[model samples]
Structures are given as C-alpha cells and as structure tokens.
Target: MGQTSTSLCCIFICFMLAQTVFQVESANILFFFGVSSYSHRLPAWPLVTGLAEKGHNVTFLSPFKAKNPHPKVVDYAPRKFSEWAESWDEMNMFDMRKKGDMYKQWLILPYFGIAMCEKLYSDEEFINWVKSSTYDLVFIDALFNECGYGMAHIFGAKVIQFDTTTVFPWYSSAFGSPDETNWIPDMAYVFGANEVTFQNRLINALIPVGWDLFRSWIYFPQLEEITRTGLSTTDLPTFQDIEKNVSMIFLNTYYSEEFARALPPNMVSIGGIAYVEKRTPLPKDLAAFLEKGNGFIYVSFGTVADLQKMDASTQQAIIGALQSFPELQFVWKLRNDSLLKEFPNGNVYISNWMPQQDILSHPKIKAFITHSGLIGIQESIYNAVPLISFPIFAEQDYNAERVHRNEYGIRLEITTVNQAELEDAISKVVNDSKYDPDFKFTQYSTNDA
Candidate 1:
C-alpha cells in the first residue's frame, strides 16, 4: 500500500510537469493598418476578434475605429488622412475610367502611402507607444501600409501581411509566386478569366513589372527613409528584407471563384474570415421598409465611393433605374439623406447606412446592386442573392467579371452605363432565376481549400 501511494504521487507530479511544459501562453499581437478604408478593416476583423477571444492582447491600429468593439481588443486610431484621400478626386477617377487612363492611377498610390506613414510617424504619442510596446507578432496591411514593417523590426516579431483582395501582380513577385501572365491577366487588366490573349499578355506582364520596379526604386526608398527618420535610427533593415522574411500572407480570396493558379505555401486564403452564419435584427424603420413591397433590391456603391460627388447625369441615371422598377422596392445605401428628395419614386428607400449583411439575409431581398467589392460579393453569394455588379475602380472590374462568368449576376460598365442599360440589368437580375448565386458551390469558409 505504501509503495502504491508513492508511485501515484510520482505520477501526479510528472503529469503536472508535462502540463507546465506543454501549456501555450497568450501572445501580444499588433495589427497595423495605416491609411486604409473601412472595407480593408472588415476582412481581417474575425482574425482580430478571434485572437482577442483566445486570450491574446490585440492592438488594432488604423485610422478607422472599430464598428463593434471587443473586450480584449484595443482600437488605436491616430489622425486620419482625410485631406489626402479627398484630394484623389472622385470625378477624376470616373473620368480616368472613361478615358481608359488606368495606368496613371497606380502612380499616385505610393505617394499616398508615404504621406500616410509620415503622418503616423509624426505623432509623438504613437512613436512613444511603439517604443515602449512589445509585440510577439505583427500583422500589417500589404497595401501602401508597409510602414508597419518598421514596428515589426523593433519588436523582433514574426510578420504577417494581409491583402484585402486576391493577390495582385506585385504580391506575386514579392512573395515569389507564379504570376503566369500568359494565362492569368493582371488585376488592373480588367478582362474576363478566359480573355487573356497574346496581344494583351505583354501589357499585363509589363504593368506589374513596371509597378514593382517603381516601388523598388522610388517607393521603398522613400518608405525606408521615412521609417528610419520616424524611428530615429538607421540600424533598421530594409523593407524588402523584412518583407521577404514574413511568416505568412493572408489573401481575401477563395479557390472556387478563382481560375486554377499556383500559390506559395506561405500564402493563405482566408476568404470568409468575416462570414457569420447568424443574422442580426435590422433597425425598426429598415425592417418596416423591407416588409412593404413584393421584395427589395439592395444597392450600394461600397464604403469609399462618394456618390454625392458623382456628376448629376450619373445620379439621374441611377435614380431613373430605380424608378423603372417601381413594382420592386429599392433599398439604396446612399449617405446623403437630403438627396432622397431627388428620387421622385416613393418606392425607393435611401439611408446613409444600414446593416448590410442583415438586409441581405432578409427573405424579401430579391437582388443586390453593388460596386462588386469582394466582401459584398462573398456575402451576396452566401445568402444566395443575385447581383447587378457595376465596377468602379481597383480590382472591382475583375470581381465583376467573375460574377458575370459564374452566372451569379450581370456586370455593368459604370462609365458607359445609361438609365436604359441600368434598368435592363436590374430588370434581368430581379426577374431571372438564372442569376441566383449557387450558395453550395460558391460558399467558402475558413475550412475551404
């Protein structure tokens, strides 16, 4: 009996020691997203919230504050670069699309990024905080928001970069992934999946290569200088060095929607990171509005689009399109409430904002009119809502092409779209069952391949 008791005590102590050795401690994570829009914030939100819930301390640093706050997450919002963003000129962008001046747009992005980094680095409080803080991991935005690389160098932490969209051409080069422009067109090319031909293939290849060279020669140098100046040290490594050693990259794309392409092991697709199975209740007024008509078609140009700044003709085209579908109620996500008076149709309900996912989840929602933003497209697919996609800028046209290719919706070129064209697109999506997104086929989750 004595021997058995002693053996049992020894076994218990061994078990305790094993537990001590195997236990995983919570980490300090810094999510640095400088000079980004609200759309950039949503895709990585689940990651932030997930880490926080798992007992890690998460610092979410961005100009945009959290729409929904989590207990374990700290939202750090510094000065917003509203002036820089506003200067981009919404009208100029529309004009550029009309004139096919897409190449010129890429030239301005680096300047914006450098300016944003300078703004962040200028804040004395932000600098002091960075100096004092110790992070185990740094998650940085892969856009012009590369300034966060300096912080990762300081903390000596593993870096994780996230792209809010599918891997761009620059991403392919930087991460050493196969771009294969012969078969796969650049995101800026604005062509269908199968439209990559011999003539435009050279153009596709050169665009990314040129952009990469511009970044390597001009953008990175300026970024390196500013980062060093901000940190007050020349001892830091170059952005390229830090970027090459990054631990992982999370892309906001799914395989089922994409053409077959080779990917590096470190690049992960966390497409439905923001997806939630449960739906939230809509506001009283919004709920009442949805209940009134046979069904509503949801329209939103996305977070960054300044529809108010759009020319009067385009605004009238949109308004007229909604009026054409008088039988079907229209729920438009327009920011200017006063502009509601411009819509003569009583069936049109305009609000600055509404719970988009909840509205999409509603049984009465017949179709979605979108800017073909990836998040909106994913959510629309998840809810089996057909789309009327009008792509504006960035990779939206690419996304719109996919929507059209998959028979998920109709893609309208916003530059050439008139009231009649808009009306026809809306009419087809609302009336035709062929446009309905195949939820089972397209729906992706964290577990998706």
Candidate 2:
C-alpha cells in the first residue's frame, strides 16, 4: 500500500512540471506601434486582442488608448506636441481642400516628418518604455515613420509592417512588382483611365526624391541630435527593405476588394481584421434610435474629420439633403451637440459617439457616407454597404479613388460638395443595382481569398 501511494505522488509531481513547461513555452511578448491617430490604432487592436486571448503578453507603444484594454497589455504613456506644433485637434480633412496641392505638399509633408520626430524624441517616457521591455516580435504601422521601425531595429526583434493605405510603390514591391507602376491595380483597368500618364509618372517619381531630400537635409539631422541616436536622415529604410526584413506585411485590405496582385511569401492580406467582433452590442440609446428607423444611411467622416470644421452652410445643406430623403433615415455622427440640435427632426438621429461597427452591421443600414479612412472602408466592405466617399487627407484620397474605380461608390470632393451633388451621389449609390452586386462580389472575394 505504501509503495503504491508513493508512485501516485511521483506521477502527480511529474504532471505539474509538464504543465509548467507547456505554459512557459506558449508564452510570448508582442510589441505594437501606433501613432496618435485613431485609424492607426484600429487595425492593431484585433491582433493585440487575439494575442492576449491566446495567453501572450502584448506591449502596445502608442500615444492613444487601446480599443479593448487587456490585462496583458503594457500601454506606454501618451506624448505631448510642441507649443508651435499643431495638435491632432488642429488637423482636419478640409485643410487639404482649403490649402490646395502646393500647400499640402509643402506644409503637410514636413508636418509628418516633424510629428514623427516629436513622438520619438520628445517622448522620453516612450523611449524608456521600449528600452525596458523585451519583445519576441514587433508589429508597426507603416506611417509610424520614425518610431515603430526604429524601435524594432533597436530591440533586434522580428518586425511586421502593417499598411493602412492602398497600394503604393513600396507596398507593390512586396507582392513581387519589380518596379512601381502608376497603375491603380484593381479598378484602374476597369475605369479605362488607369495606368500612369507620363506626367503623373514623372511627378510620382519626383515626390519620393524630394521627400528623401527633405528628410535627409532637414528632418533627420535635427531628429538625430534630439534623440541622441545615430539614426541619420538617410538611415530611413525604403518600404521594400522594411517589408523584406519583417516577418510579414499585413494590409488592412482584402484581395477581392483590391486590385488582385501577386505578393511575396511574407506579405499577407488580412483585411477586415477590425470587424472580428461577432456582433458587439450597440449603446442602448443609439440601438433604440436605429431600431425605430425603417432603414438608415450612416454618415460619418471618421474620428479625425470634425463636422464643425465644415462650413455651417455645408452642414445645413447636408441636413436638408437627409431630410428630403424621409423614407431613408439618417444616423449622422456629428461631434458637436449644436450641429445635432440644428437637425431636430426625428428622422435624423445625432450621437456624439455611436457604435460604428454595430451600426454598419445592422441590416437596416443601406449606405455609408465616409471619409475613406482605411478602417471605415474595410468596415463598409465587411458590412457590404454601398459607399459615398468624401476623402479628406492622407491615404483617404487613395481609398476614395479606389472605391469610385471599383464601381462600389461615388467619390465626392469635400471642398466642392453641395446639397445637389450630395443628394445625387446618395441616389446613385442607393438606386444602382450594379453597386451592390459589385460590392457583394468584392466582399465575397476578399473573404474567400
């Protein structure tokens, strides 16, 4: 009896040791890079959440909050911008329309450089946080121009580049394109005006050269000194190099919705990563309001584009247009309460914050009026809703162009939009059978691929 009892005790001890070994082997540390923008954070959220759920530790290095905070997350503190610097609050899509191409190229180009430097150099807390944490892998947004890639290099960890934009030359190379083409891959051919014109090609070529010059001559020299790091302006790697060295490239896009292109082994299309929530419940007030409507057209310029920045007349015009379409309810995400009050009709429901994903997934939502942020575009594709894209800045113009070319939506220039144009665009999207058919096909292909 004593011998048998001793054998059982030994077996139990061995089982506990094996369990501990398995737990340690399964554990890993993942570092994420996110800039201040809401769009940048949105895509990373799913991966971070998934990793944590799988019992891995995630350290998110960003100036924004993680959407779904997890116990495993080690969030770095937010950084402040300089006094002369424009806060994210100062940025709006209208700036692109009001400023024109020349101003945008000059002012905005440098702005990104400065913003990157500020986030990396001024934020000592972030630098310290990164140095202290040891990560098995790093996932960075492509726009984290200075910090993400740089940190990954500093830590000597495997990196993954996450693109929130449509195909640019750098991205194209990952998919085995030997050279950058001016062609918009998916719909450019369908649009008939696709392919790079000589002038367009020339301009595209010059922009990168000019950008390199700007970075080398101005941005990098200043940044190197501030950070006390050896990173020179010329030290910046091309998108190709970043893609090559990284573990993989995950685009916030899908194959069906995008121009089908051949990709490298390291590049993966995991579009609609943001829509993983099976059916997140909407806020009670917003859900109740949505239920009351026959069907709704969801209008939002995403998180960055402030409705208040739009001229009051433009705002009124939008309200009037929505009111005219009484049969179709309008759920406008207007940030300012005054603007919401201006449209008091029960047909139009205003919310400072809405469950965007829930509303998009709702069967009652017929159309999406968006600013063409990658996240918003992906959500529209996932929900299979027709779009009216009014792109403001950054990659939005690129996203909007693709949507129009794909025949899934109409692209309205925000600077020139009016009631008639807005109404016409909405009518075309809602009335056109081809739009929905193409959209559904695109969604299917994206998911299947």
Which one wins on TM-score?
1
Give the per-residue lDDT digits (tens) of candidate 1, residues 112-230. 78988887778787788889999999998877788888889988899998888888788767888887777666776866756667678878878778878987998888888988998
lDDT of candidate 2 over 153-182, digit per residue (tens): 556678877766544443433345433445
> Each candidate's lDDT (Cα)?
0.81, 0.67
Using lDDT as the measure, which candidate wins?
1
Could you tally the backbone clashes for each prediction? 0, 2
- True lDDT of residue 243, candidate 2: 45
Off by over 4 Å in 2: 1-36, 79-86, 102-110, 170-177, 185-196, 205-222, 229-244
Error of 1 at 430 (Å): 1.7
Cα RMSD (Å) per model?
A: 3.4, 4.4
How much is 393 displaced in model 1, in angstroms?
1.3
**Local error of candidate 1 at residue 399 (angstroms):** 0.9
